[model samples]
Target: MAFHYPNGTPYNNHEAPKSKKQVKKQKSIQFGKRGMDFEEEINKSNAYYLSRNTAVIHKKPTPVQIVKVDYPSRSAAVIKEAYFRQASTTDYNGVYNGFYLDFEAKETKNKTSFPFKNFHQHQIDHIRQCLAQKGICFVLLWFSSLNRCFFFSGEALVTYWAEQETTGKKSLPLAIIEKNGIEIQIGIAPRIPYLDAVEQYIQSKKGVAMNDN
Candidate 1:
């Protein structure tokens, strides 16, 4: 018997119903044998930042309500049943250079555009709230198919999201993203060197403020 989701649909332990070895092989092929996921790369990057005392960012743990628990042994306890209690705000948050940082990391297989459905209203609202406090809010978007990554500003994303309601745009085109977002070069040590992009964004903001003044 296979495990079924709350919706009654059987969960495919693998993305496709493939054998364990086959799934492993496929993942190696997909990630060029490195087998690193976007979140994993970001985690590595965060760890690198922390090691040098540059920044302290961590992934926010999802809140879950444990409905049942099983104590198989004195030292081992397994969660028999659990459910998400509420929606999460974002993936990572921390402080760097006396600035509060908040961001969500997401990836898409789409080559031409990133679907707006990937983002939730609550996450958008949370970003807006952070921006109100002058926190550095942004999103790290990974285009897996294109092998590209970008640092997109929270304000621009919020603006585009608001326009979607009236414009009826279903996705953000790659061209628009290229125009507005900073491209992040994938690296080996830190994997996704996103802090460089953050620094650039901060400088750009300062330039705009100087011009305004």
Candidate 2:
């Protein structure tokens, strides 16, 4: 069953993007492939990977600066005052196959384009910096309405984000993503299975060399 917000917008803690107001709409999906929310799936997939020692990717802790703390009865400490320290680099980062992997996960219900508003300027700059250090950077884009997921490289996202003013493209079209990104299949055990998509992407970039004699 799909989880819906108070206003009737379907959102699951697992796959739903962190947005204040969700688009009040629903998209239909056929049988057999239906499953839980996107974020939930990704979290489960990460757990699967961690259990198998396949990767060490973890969601970055929220940056918070504790200003005041109250110790009540020597058993509980209550946070009286706190503030966000700063914007974080990305959602997830870790070491996989000797390569540093960093990425952000996001979801959108827009059927036309993936909005740039979903990403912060700081994140774009961070991806660029990670690319400079040879890190495997990407974004897990979940199209909730279409029930599709894409692993798009940071280079593509950065290039397009930079050209927004020149091209006047406020969002990335599905066509562009189809050409450049790798589509991932959602499954039960792991959910998002984005790492599988990442492996495919890495192999595609490596060409036939890894397969040849």
**Which predicted model would earn the best TM-score?**
1
Candidate 1 residues lying further than 4 Å off, grouped into runs, are 1-36, 70-75
TM values, all candidates? 0.81, 0.79
TM-score, model 1 to reference: 0.81
Error of 2 at 200 (Å): 1.4
* lDDT by residue for model 2 (88-138), tens: 598788988898999988777777678887788889999999999989899
Per-model clash counts, in order, read 0, 5
User: What is the Cα-based TM-score of model 2?
Assistant: 0.79
Model 2 clashing-pair count: 5
Positional deviation of residue 131's Cα in model 1 after best superposition, in angstroms: 0.6
lDDT of 1 by residue, 29-106 (tens): 123223446765787788889888999888766556899999999899999998755555876899999989999887
Assess each prediction's global lDDT (C-alpha) against the native: 0.81, 0.76
Runs in model 2 with CA error above 4 Å?
1-36, 208-213
lDDT, candidate 1, at 208:
98
Query: Model 1 RMSD to the real structure?
Result: 7.8
